[model samples]
Target: MSGTWQCSPAELEVHLGFRESNPQSKHAEFLGPPFLTVCCLLPSFSRLDMDRFLMRNVTKGTTTVKRKKSLDNDDDVETAEDTETMQRSQKISKKNNFDDENEPQTERIETLCQTFSEILTTDLVWKKVIKSNLDLSHTILFSKGIANTVMELLEEEVVYFTGDLAKVQVFGRWHNIPRKQATYGDPGLTYKYSGKETPGRAWPPVVKAVRDLVNRVTGYHYNFVLINRYKDGQDKMGEHKDDERELHPDTPIASLSLGQTRDFYFRHQDTRPPKKLNIDKVQMPLHHGTLLLMNPPTNRYWYHALPPRATAKGVRVNLTFRKVVPAAASSSSNNKQ
Candidate 1:
């Protein structure tokens, strides 16, 4: 039982007396008082919905600090107050403050559990997930284009290796490819798009299809997409974002998954004891042939990753689409054949 877990105090109750109870009788009449008493003795355990209650009270303007640790002191209190003020100012003054292209994205991806028909039929402002902002027709066409393009890249021998995000292990095992301005999707794993500065053509159609899917769903055209292949449960990406210089400010990078279901987890950009989100329980099981679009403002507040699961095995491919403008193309290659 989780209560038996030794990691935290809250876990004690889960295992409390279970070992003895099992030996006594299979159907021993165990009333709730012991559990209730144990809960009462623990810190903050008496309240079943403590966090929710605290959050609700905060919103309702009832301010109280439920518990304080022995580590607290006058200096600590002053520092906490100062930190809170600074965070407030930063939130107000900053826009996409954590844009590290190498860092995993900071948007919490939501997996819609609604029935497929209900999702597709509902006339929400964002209907179906396609590449960022691309129309349905364009989405199809671009996918075809990307497939052809990647094939060509392979044929031309431009790519040294073509694999999934998990296979490369560029980022740490527990993290996803980060793509914020600071780091930009774990550079070690992200395909070397412009690193060598080759005058290669735009990403081939397979890549484009991936890109188009993201653009249509997220409503932005990413200039580039670094494709990574993860074959089986062993492969993984670390936490990072796509805040690269090439990425337009506020552009949402879209990811399209193919070939396997993987858990995609997300957490807030910063953490305060009460502010942490329930990310571990809320991860999306990214299914094969699914499109996930992170909202543009997502980076400013959250960070996401593809954590490894022991149960997962087999290959999964993800195409993260972005828009990159070529300096040479913009200046002189406008009409060149």
Candidate 2:
């Protein structure tokens, strides 16, 4: 059985389970399970059919496992790619949000600064006049268009104080203030006068723009602006010195005027009442869009006022910008207590 064996077609049909069509032919066809046993025992017997069947099943199983492993590796690569893409997108979104918030504001500020520089260089009319301790510098700061825009903005957005804050206590007598007033500045800044205190409000855009322009032109930093709106010439301010304890020592006060023209008078401290010293009073007309910087020692030695004039019938808005020392303001409040 180990070597080749010759057999009749009839014997082959019984052992191999197939009937050969040609009985006289030498080739025989193996058909069923009987061939499996015969091929396992006899090495020379026809075993090609069994070998081919087992090889096909083994190849199919190996191919299936390889395909599954490849598919799993592809899934892992895709998941990592998706995670990396999501992280990159989040970072880009945050950067875009930051740019959206700040870029426009920064560009606007820079543009304003450039416009101010141009206007100051070409159109400014500077005049410096010094009288005794009064160091004054006058200039036409704003153009007609800019001045009108500012007035419109103020009318629309600015809110004046009401109730107790709308009145001032003078000489133990409480009276309604003649003019509408407001204060805008940094936090904790307060302006106290005539036995009343005016707390600072947050700076409005128009006010901040004007302040930045003033600072650029005068090379001085001002943190607070006292805004006074006179309805007519009859609404006036009495003689007073702006020598408050909360003010920064030696800093100049920038006064910007809009609308009607009004006469500003400065009298020496010694020239009033009992002293009656022989000193000439200074008078200047503050016109629309004008800027007046009162330098150091002016408030210390002079009393300034805007008297009533029936001829000046139009409304006037005055912004007096000053620097406030927060520590000094706190100390002043403590002293009162």
Candidate 3:
């Protein structure tokens, strides 16, 4: 009576209650002066009755929403109450919609990753199986394909080693030089050989890529590569181990070979006790475009060399990757050569 009836009583009377009541009973008697209620308390139903009907229908229908918007005065812009009501409605919607899928619905996040064998060092189709012969030296071969790529980059433009007189000279003449050697590494690292301080060269692209690949496979990083270019079989390395003071004591040395194949030998450092002599020498033919990873303790316990291969032909490039201890980093700061 206070305000005009908003809901269509004639339309909803049968749906609300009239159809179920006795036909003899008047319409007013069936519904008892129907006063509709929306969200909050109104005049018709008792407190508990209104709350029960509201609590039940609020979770099931659009009635709660239409009523909440009426309080907002039909404005298009939402008030805080409207926002809170919408949020609650959303939570109810989510809860009601949370049905168990016939098979548990799984969201698959597809991603792809490349392995060392898949991208770089090994046979493209086969798994990269690292072979370890622990007697004299622990060495693993990367691939010929990658090795060729590395060589192409290095051979393009090279800066040979110079200024180290002793490295190239034995006695009075400059005759002892077996092969040309160039040191490439972090800036400021100086290694003294041939009676002169040889500072390292800045890393080149091919060399840096090899370093990255080595780190990915072996889990070790190197800051330097002692590049030895053997022009032919005549160019050979002596029977000696890389036990330099500047190198990291525990890290392995990575020797990558390119071009021609050659024989590389490892012998027990004569200093080891007689009991270990049974494992005296290990000789292996190092093929072209292969990487020989000489892990730790090999330098600690064995002596290795590229003994002159008399019948060998073509140029063989060797890149021996090594690490200089962090402690020596400061020492080389003063001189780059």
Candidate 4:
């Protein structure tokens, strides 16, 4: 009416009805629709000012009306701002998933080390040793909970050999090895068996922690560990000795077992058939968290094997920690070169 009015488009349309055209009107060209009839009614406002006011009011009115209609109709109408927010949320979710999938391996190892260090115990319970030159010093190095955590950590961190390295050559042909195997130890150290030579990898944090624990308990420094994972009763190790040339002479080999209880057989090397040796083969159940130290003379006379058993349904992981002579390894490498 006077200076300015803040009426909506619908209210303005209702107040100013369509009027007959005045041919001689000064702003007749701008007077056509019911909404634009304000041009004729409000002559005090200039053309540009009127256009801006109408545009702003009309846009606001249209948005309000659409929102009201959508609410009445139960429609899920998304505004421009709402759509942009949703798009940003989706992008953030995808980035989080990518970050989780590509987590740093070193961070994972550190976490495993912390976890084992907290749960593992230093208290030892020595079991009686039935065989000569064998030390079952710590029947239980880890409690049930610690053993379970160790198995889980091993499952998450251990990486076994693949392709040709995964197979073992027996007799003349190569066959898939019954159990998964991995080696970790000092640099430049290698273990050879069945026509395959496996170089030692850097020790993972979980493995290094366990190695330190074994070393403290046994009072011996070991530089190499051969890990064997038996999936079930079907996976096994053949009767053989850890008599590799790289092993330190007279040093004991520490065998740590985790997971399922399995039979570990030790047969005298001379008691094949023709020999009149009266020595009986030793059958020991390598239970979870048991540490069996095969001292010097044991490996010399006994051939140990983890024969497959139909009753063993659970997985078993064995870590045989050995002291490898660095000089011997270097000499062997020089000869090969």
Q: Number of the top candidate by TM-score?
A: 2
Question: Which digits, one per residue and each the tens of the lDDT, describe model 4 over residues 1-337?
Answer: 0001233443222212111111242221211122211111111122222222221122211211112132334454545633443354345334333223244656545543443443223223344445654333334455343465567778887898898888754345667877888989988887665556778899977788889878876789999998989999878775566776778877788888999888776667566434567776666677676777887777666666676667889999999899889888777667766
* Runs in model 3 lying further than 4 Å from the true structure: 1-143, 163-166, 169-176, 193-196, 271-279, 329-337
C-alpha lDDT values of all predictions = 0.35, 0.61, 0.49, 0.59
For candidate 1, which ten residues in a row score worst on lDDT? 34-43
Where does model 1 exceed 4 Å of error?
Answer: 1-202, 209-219, 272-282, 325-337
**What does candidate 3's lDDT look like per residue over 1-337, in tens digits?**
0001123333222222223212452212111111122332111112222222222124222224222333334344544644555465345324333211231212100000111223322211111212233322222233332344446557864577655532443234444356777777887675543334555788765566666666665568888778888888777665555666677877877777788877776656543333434653555665554556676666656666565655777889888878877466555444544
Order of models, best lDDT first: 2, 4, 3, 1
On residues 110-223, what C-alpha lDDT tens digit does candidate 1 reach at each position? Answer: 101111111211112222322222211111111111222233332332242322421222123332222111112212222222111223245543344434445544557566
Give the root-mean-square deviation of each candidate in angstroms. Answer: 22.7, 47.5, 37.7, 36.8
Sorting all predicted structures by TM-score, with the top scorer first, yields 2, 4, 3, 1
Residue 313, candidate 4: C-alpha displacement in angstroms: 1.1
How big is the RMSD of model 3?
Answer: 37.7
Q: Candidate 1: lDDT of 138?
A: 11
Error of 2 at 110 (Å): 10
Clashes of each: 92, 0, 3, 0
Q: What 10-residue stretch in candidate 2 is worst by lDDT?
A: 35-44
Model 2, 183-301: lDDT tens digits are 89888887776556678899887788888888887888899988989899777776667888788877888999998878776778777655667877777777667788888888888
